[model samples]
Target: MTDPDTAATDAHLLETLANLRWNRFHTIVVLLFGLGWALDAFEVTLIGNVLGALRQHFHLGSNAMSFILAAWFAGLMLGASGFGILSDRYGRRRVFLASLVLYGVATLATAFAPDLAALMVLRLIAGIGVGAEYAAINAAIAELVPSRSRGRASAIVLNFWPVGSFVAALLAWLVLSALPADLGWRVVFALGGAIALSAAWFRRHLPESPRWLIEAGRREDARVIIGRIAAGLTDATTLAPAPVVQRVRREVNGLRVLLRHYPGRLALGAVLDFAEASGYYGLFAFLPIVVLPALHLPPARLPLFYLAGSVGALIGGFAAASLLDRIGRGVTVAGFYLATALALIGFAAITGMGAGAIMLGFALVNLLATGSWIAAYPMFAELFPTSLRATGIGASVAVGRIGAALSPFLVGYVGARSMPAALVMLAGFWALGAVAVLVWRRRGGIEARGLALEQLAVEPARYV
Candidate 1:
């Protein structure tokens, strides 16, 4: 009961898409997609780096500051879910640009806060914009890039988070070293917003995903975009027009669809995200407040540690990007997770040791732990079907945001009791993520390496 041309028409378009050689458009997608995530990292790193200064200026204790950080995470959860649904339903372009402006203005406003409460309010709003980036950017990148280099491309893009952190640390150190304590931290925040505002120009040139258009049943629009893309594959490209399959595709509406289809993937995504947030927000975020003070390091000196860790992060990101496509995702994710656990456990064992030993341990944690991010975002983005990709990613990020939101408070409680205990607990979070990936892979999770999204999602299993 099928047209013989069905396989050559809609399915053929995906083949041409997957086979297209790298082009300028692909590079543009990578940089722009990565920027959304980087801004989030820049803001987070700036706040974490400057927390010590904020506490002192506001006359606030550890717990009070923890609650303020929690406010930011709460906003991230709200925005990830809210904008994800909006982007998935309405379109990615509108939400992506709009959130940038919103977060930019909010982050800029944060520098002028009259009091701690005012800063908290602004941070919450800025967080929503950052949160929106996770789903919109990931979904778009997954669909836009060629299938052959998809894993490496996604890894490279998501790894921008570390680059943002590095830049933030450098900026923080420079500002704090030169300016007075009160003015220095404020300037760091203002700069983050200014950088985000500039990204609107590059993002404007990005094209919508053809797969999403086809999935949405916009046949002519999909063909037009695909025609332009196919023609520009190279000077000698002779790609043909994609067949117009007129079958009515049933589109599901709501988060419930994810549960019905990819319950395991959805669950695993939430666990990885939640666990990553717990460790990052709990240990790394709290380190400046707790460990740095113990080491007799000033706030300005925090970037030195961040700088050292970022070296490992850059190394890790590059390694993950190279190794992910070669070694299977299962091996990469598990290997990185296991390495991170060991780093944390090692850090916990030598807690009262000299600052040098502590710093080395933290550096290893950043190298291995942050490196795993290369695989994490891509894994989640690739696992779900095209129709549900944004919502699925959004849901997972929302769950992770819950863990991220709670992590600050939890860090205060545990760190107050014993820093050693906190490190050990944070290690447990990474261990759990490793376990989740292994378990999910065993449950027949599909790897998207060098595979077109249309065949994997839009067609039947035999065709795939």
Candidate 2:
């Protein structure tokens, strides 16, 4: 070959290698993060699915079980807030690893709970771990991915929640109901503990986010980790090093810093998150009761209802993942919430009208609303810069978790009075969430994917 032709070919080969490396890096991050997310989903959603068993085991009623679930979410709210601040201050690496251990130990402890009080305490601790882990992992993913692909990547990783929840539902059906009471729930708790080990394994694969590293003024360390990550992919060998990142160190304050500066973002994050939590958790946490009566199934058959909803959630997650990249984040989230609100209202009407409608509407609402919003985590994380990414997201999640924690209590309270009233209340919450998300998009930018990671790395004081 001519010398000029040889040079062109070599350049093309290097370019192809670079593209491959980038894709591999993206895929590995998503899969590792997704695995952790799945475990989180399993623990969080398991409460709803297993409520029947717990109620029967404790010789309690639905209202009491709702209280138990609420306690878990309350703990989640506190955990997310506290751990989010700690993660940002100490580093995602330490916070992430610690949360895994905390939740795992808590879950194991749950298996040995002798009474409702013991169960509630263990679940609260487990909830804290689950809540904190979500903030840490989501922040980690937000920092790791490039801006252009952030929405899609976030959607994909977030989809694992349904995957884990569905798997847990299936296992609860196969294992919990069939086994003796003590053994059954204990096994499920053991599973939750076992699954948490994935966090440790997952952290091994993840290096500190380059964005976080840059913000911390560890450019050399960031560069070395990036090189190792690059080498992990079978694309480029002896690749050009990533550019050195220089970031300013800023005085770190807690929520006060958020209140003083970027109040707009904080308000936006909190309102939007609160709405989502209310809508998502309100319906999801009550899935068993919603479906059990309508399906006309025996107590033994109730799990099938959960299993179906879980499938819907899983499918919805995958569908959300598929469209997140193509559709704008604002449009996707608003559209889902809007549709969900309408569908839920319709569901209440239909179910109130008759039995057949109840069965159908219950399935549709669960599938669409819960599944669609799984993609929102990335968009939420993107709303703030790196310095407060965890804090912002964590605080929002904490607020939302409060809503979630309350949802079951709200449902049980209303259900005792009237089922139709409960459904109407849920529809209202969904509408509220839909409105909050729409307003957020109108005020903020339309395309959250365009947000640069470096911008997130900007100190809180200088954020623009």
Best by lDDT: 1
Given candidate 2, what's the lDDT at residue 162? 77
The Cα RMSD in angstroms, rounded to one decimal, for candidate 2 relative to the true structure is: 7.0
Regions of candidate 1 where Cα sits further than 4 Å from its true position: 1-8, 230-252, 458-464
Where does candidate 1 have its weakest 10-residue lDDT segment?
234-243
- Alpha-carbon lDDT, every model: 0.78, 0.70
lDDT, residue 358, candidate 1: 74
Model 2: residue 459 alpha-carbon error in angstroms: 9.9
Q: lDDT tens string, model 1, 103-182?
A: 88899999899999899999999989888888888888887778888889989988888898889889998999999889
Q: Write the per-residue lDDT of candidate 2 for residues 1-464, one digit (tens) a residue.
A: 24776545433432322233346777887887788888888887677667767767887766777778888888889889988987776667667778888888898788888999999998899889888887798888776665667777788888888788778778888876688755777788888788787566655656666556555645456555556655664222232332223211242465676777766567656765776677777776555555554444444455566667677777777777777677766677777767777787777666556545655666678777765567567666776766678888888888888778788788767766767677778778767766766665566543554556544434443222
Error of 2 at 135 (Å): 1.1
- Measured with C-alpha atoms, the lDDT of residue 390 in candidate 2 is 87
Q: Which ten-residue region of model 2 has the weakest summed lDDT?
A: 239-248
Give candidate 2 regions above 4 Å deviation.
Answer: 1-21, 233-252, 289-299, 352-359, 444-446, 455-464
